[model samples]
Structure formats: C-alpha cells, structure tokens
Target: MTEALAVPRIASPEERITSIIALASSVDGVDIVVAAHEGFTYSVQALNPEYEIYADELAAASAVYLESSWQKLTGNARVILADQGGKALLVADVGEGFTVAILGERQAVESLLDPVRRLATGAPISCPNCSAVLDVHTYTCPSCGKRIPFTATLCPYCGTASPARSCPNCGAELMLAPGRVEPAKAEKQRSAVAVTPRAQSNEGEVVSEEKGETPLLIRLTIGGGVVAAYYASSLLLGIDPVIATIVGAAPLAASLGLILTEKRRQ
Candidate 1:
C-alpha cells in the first residue's frame, strides 16, 4: 500500500552559488571558488585552508579593494586580477552586486568563467537531462552524460534548449563581452606594468581617498571685487591715503570672513 502511494521527486531544489562551487570543485584543475564583494570574502567556496590560507586572504583583500578601486577609476573593471603569486587572482563581474574569485590553473579556471557570470545575472544552471544542479566541473552531466555548458544553446545529447539571458556584465545577445577588456590589457598594449598591488607591512602606511567640488568661480569673483576696491580707494576716492588704505582693506577682510563662515556652516 505504501509503495502504491509513493511518487517520484520532480527535481533538485533551486540552484545556488554554494552548490555551484561544490560542483565546480570537481573540475580537473579548479582549486578555489570564493564569493567576495567590496574587499571581503563572504564564502571560501572551496580551498585547502592550509597553504592557500595566505593566498586566499590576499585574494580576498585585493578582490574587494582593487575591484572597487577600479570601478571608481573606470566606472567598471569588467574583471580584475587582484593579486597573484603562486595562484592567479581574478575578480569577474558576477552581477547582483557580488563577484566570484576563481584561483587556480588560469586556463582551466577560466573555463568556468561563464558559469559565475550566469549566476550574477540571476539565471542559475541545472542539468538539461534530469534538471540536476551543475557548475564548471560539470562539462558532462552524470545524470545522463549529456554534454553541457549552456552556452551551446542546446544540449547535444538531450536536445534541451539553453535558457536565454541578457548578460549581467555585458548585455550582448549570445557572445560574452570578451569581458570588459581587462584594464592591464590596455596598458600592456601601451607598455605599462599594471601588476598586483604590493603586499606590504607598514603600520604607518596610510591610504586615503577624497571626492567633492570647490566654489572656484565664487572665490575668484570675491578676489576680483577686493582688487577693484583697493584701486578705487587709492585712485578714485582721493581721501587721506592712510584712511583709504585702511577702509579698502576692511571690505576685503569682511568678504573673506563671510566666505569662511559660509564654508564652515556647510
């Protein structure tokens, strides 16, 4: 009777970044998948946690710092190589206000770039055959051995259509934006070294940033008025030279004091 009442499960729950990285770990050369944003690591998706703890730490800091810094400079980095020593560092746009840092064999790790990109855009990946979850590690589905990549537009084995999408990073129809042209690539073409940010130990080292505008035209007008008054007092008024000098200086002093007062109030 219990067997008669049983029904098959429809599919796995919705896909997510955590599960995505778990699958990516199975890829032959992918070593680490970290979810990072704004100079902090939210999840060390996959790692050894021993030898890579230092690299991971550096990667996390640079991921957040360099990406944000680059955005401030170029309005977008499209992607950034934050830090690298034994491991290559990358911060690719994952959209949704977050990014994924993949550190491993540069070529192999890059293979999954499309996957991270899909996630950022809110279109998660799943197997075409059985609707099983998938990641870069999943070039071929275990559920049915159906070839995948989603970029292919249709599963060669299953004939299932790939979901249509508007890239979170680059809104191109089918092609990825070759990725917002890595910043270093531009410099390399121009003979420059846009290398990793130096990892230094200096408690006294200071990093600072500032943005705003000053009332330049106003200040210039104030100064011009003061100069005109100085000349008017000495040449036009024809009062006692000493008295005119003192009186002319008064307006200049008063104007400056008013300017300072206005700034302080703001």
Candidate 2:
C-alpha cells in the first residue's frame, strides 16, 4: 500500500456509493468487494468468480456485517472474530455510514487496515508541544506557534525544554514554557534591575538609579555631629549620660523622619 491516500468526500449519494467501491479495490488482497446502499434494495459488488460468494447474499451480508462487527468488537474482551479455518474479519470506520470491504487472509487484511485508517481518519502526525495536528510540509506547530523541529528537546516559542527534568543554568526544577517569562525568573530579573547601578531609558529620558552606598562626606558629617552633641550635653551642660543620649536622639529622630518620608507619586 502507498504511504499517502486521499480521504474522499462525495457530493451525492450515488457518488458516495461509487467511492466506497473505488476505495475497496485500491487496497491489496481485495479479492471481492461490495458497496451496499442505505437500504437492501441495491448494491454494487465486484463480479469476480475467483472467490466463491454469491453477490446478492454478499451485498446483504456486508450490510449486516458492517453493523454487527463494530458492536461485537466493543462488547467482546478480545475484540476480534475468527472462524475455525483461520479466516478472519477486520473492520474499521471509513466515515459517512459507508464501509469498504477487503477480502483476504487474517494477516494480510490486518496489515492493510491501519494504513487505510490513516487515510480515512486523516494524516496522524501531531505536534509534540501542543498536541495539535501538524501539516506534513511544515515543521512549525500551528497550535502553539512553536517553530522547533519535531524531534527537538525544547520548544522554541514556549521555553519548555524537557526530558532533562530541570534546567542546568539556573538549577530551576521546572523552567516552564514561553522562555524566561516565567514568574520566578521574571521576579529575579526585576530584582536584578533594582540592585544593578545602571541607567535605564524611560520614554526617551535617561533615569539613573542611585547607588546603595552612602556618600563619605554625609557619613562623616553626621557621625561628627552625633559625637559632638553627646559630649557637649554631658560635659558642658553637666547632664547625665542617659539624659543626654535621650535628648540627642529626639531631634535626630525627628530630622530623619522628615527626610525619609516617602514622596507620593501622582
């Protein structure tokens, strides 16, 4: 059997019946085939005498066979039927209340069944990323919009890399899809932006973030003022050390509070 087969669609009842016969004959080991109409009134059967089955009886039998076979397969545990002589029957859905009969030995018939099913059910290739049906010609997965090859370990669109269990670079237990946009990674990036002493462009204006280190002059000035005030209150004013410390901290706390109060952004 050929690798590719077209799934046929017919416009009319007559055309659908004709198509069933055409499809049946296309497969290997189809010694005799029949296409039964919706009713038992008319049927089209291949008039080959090599296989000894009456056409009228076959036409009637095929209709009943198609109906009963699928039910039996569903109901039974083994899901297959075989006669004592080793002759077997295999059935599959060809869609549209129509069935194509293939007459052959059990093994040969079974082999052709899956390939015919591929044609009838459409091409079976699927996207590993999204499970969407993939077009035979294109490597891009249409569903998730990933452009990676089918056998690739990672999906290029969604940062989903797999089968490794975890990321080597970050040691993240799960990197997830859609690249470094994952919540944990994104939060890390935000933290990086906040800490790094770099200027960022905000709508054509340069906005530089301040370095976390305090200025040397400001540190020296504040330290000198604190020591001088403490000594002056203790030695010159003749106040107790505890009293001087409390009094000194009162003004300093007020001044620091005034300076550190956050400005509201409008």
Candidate 3:
C-alpha cells in the first residue's frame, strides 16, 4: 500500500499538436486538420485517407505563407477564416508560434473559431456582466430582436453600434468594448484622421487642397499627341528619325518626372 506513485507523463509538443488537430478534425464537417509550429508542419490529418501523400507538403506551404501574412497584416490576430471553392479554411494561431489549420464547411469552421481562439489565448470571451462564455456568432441584437453573428462592431440588421450586448446566459448587460486599444490600430486611426482634407489659412483666406493637378486622362492624351507629332514630323517633314525620337521623348520624360515628384511629395 506504501508503494511509490508513478508520475504522469507530460505530452511532447508533437503530441500536443497532434491532439489539437485530432480534436478539430472530430468536428462534424471538418475534413482536414493540420498543425504547425514556427512555420514547420507537425501533423496532418484528413477524413479522407487518400490525402496522406501530399498533406504534409501542403500544410507546410500553407503555414509558412499564412504566418508571414499574419505577421504583416496584424500581429495580434489569433484567428483567420477564408473560403475557397466552397470549402472553408480556418487558421488559428495558438500562443508561442503554434498554429492549427482546419479545412471544412464554412459553418462548421466558423463555429470552431472561438474554441480555437480560447485554446490559443487562454482567455475565454466571457460576458462582462455574468462571466458566461459568449458565443459571438449567435449574438442576439437588442435593437432588431434578431439573432445574428456579431463579428463586426455593429449589428447588421438594425445598424446599431454594438458597444454592449445582453448576456444570453444571465440576461445581464455585457460590455462589448475591448479592454484596450491595440497600438497599431490606434495609430492607423490617427493617421486616417490626420490625412483628411482640411481648410488651411492662406493670407486670411481659407485654402483647400481639393483641386488636384491635371487629370491623368488629359495628361496621357497630351503625351500621346506630342509623341505622335514627333513621329509624324519625322515621316512627313523628313526630319532625322533619331533626332525626332529624342525630341519626342523629352516632353514625355518631363511629364513622368513631374508625376513622380508629385507622388513623392504627397
């Protein structure tokens, strides 16, 4: 009775990833599951057994491309969903560079998004009032009294801003505002406002930048006319073809330089 107790074995990274893949694949409409860490494929599984041959390669390529794009697009994004050829592709970034990719029906993949996000972030989306797990996809709009997905910042049916929602479990008011604004998002918003057209005081008169340079269509037409005139002069007036070509290119070159300089200034 006093025998030594055996310690539980800890699962390896591969095992953990494999388990997560298996869990996702078990969902009804899930057809394939792939797990990767730091752009390296760890496991690949599919409902159809015949896909074993190229699954690993496909998973590796997908992980690399997705990881790169994810870093460039949004550093804090934990989940991404896309549809291609009627199949849904879901990529979840679990913490510490671990990622899981699942392919299945759109509805099924969307349902799994929150669960995967919870697993990766270790933070469940709970109701602010009652601490109940919130299902964003099944949110009920208070204004429209209709159930709809609350993926964006507004209720689609009534066009009401969703700063809060009623908790489905406890019927209590839950705040939908994010706890903190991300630096990148905040900066982007600020930049957008900064770039907005504004009136500037010039000699006590308001000046606006609304009037732009020559229209692109007119510029192109003028350039084409100049070039065509050069060619025509070379043919009809018997001017040296090489000299005509050089003279014709001068105006076009100047126009291009001005365009580039304007773009750089802007």
Tens-place lDDT digits, model 3, residues 1-266: 34422221213434334434644665556678877767676677887665555456556655555655553222343667776447777777655567777777676576566555544454445444444444322554567664444323455445777655545555554445443112234445676777534422452232223334545446667877898799888999899988898899888877777777776886
Per-residue C-alpha lDDT of model 2 across residues 1-266, encoded as one tens digit per residue: 43433323433434434543444444334455544444232444443455535445544555566556543221121112323124444443344454444455553344344333433344333323333322211123344553332223344444455422222222333223321213245555777879644344452242222321234335445755885689686977788878787766765565455445422221
lDDT string, candidate 1, 1-266, tens digits: 22221212212212344544554565545567676555466566555555346444744565555446443212232455444566655555443344556676554455555555544343444333333323323444444554344333434345555434333222323321223212223434544443334533232243211111245346647766875677677777566666666765676676677767766875
Clashes of each: 2, 3, 0
Report clash pairs, candidate 2.
158-178, 159-178, 159-179
Greater-TM-score candidate between 1 and 2: 1
Q: Using alpha carbons, what is the TM-score of model 3?
A: 0.37
Q: What's the true lDDT of residue 56 in model 1?
A: 49
Predicted structure 3: clash tally: 0
On the 0 to 100 scale, the lDDT of residue 220 in model 3 is: 61
Error of 1 at 42 (Å): 1.9
Q: How close is candidate 2 to the true structure, as a TM-score?
A: 0.31
- Candidate 1 stretches with Cα past 4 Å from truth are 1-16, 55-59, 62-83, 93-97, 124-137, 140-266
| Residue 240 shift from truth in candidate 3, angstroms | 99
Model 2 poorest 10 in a row by lDDT: 73-82
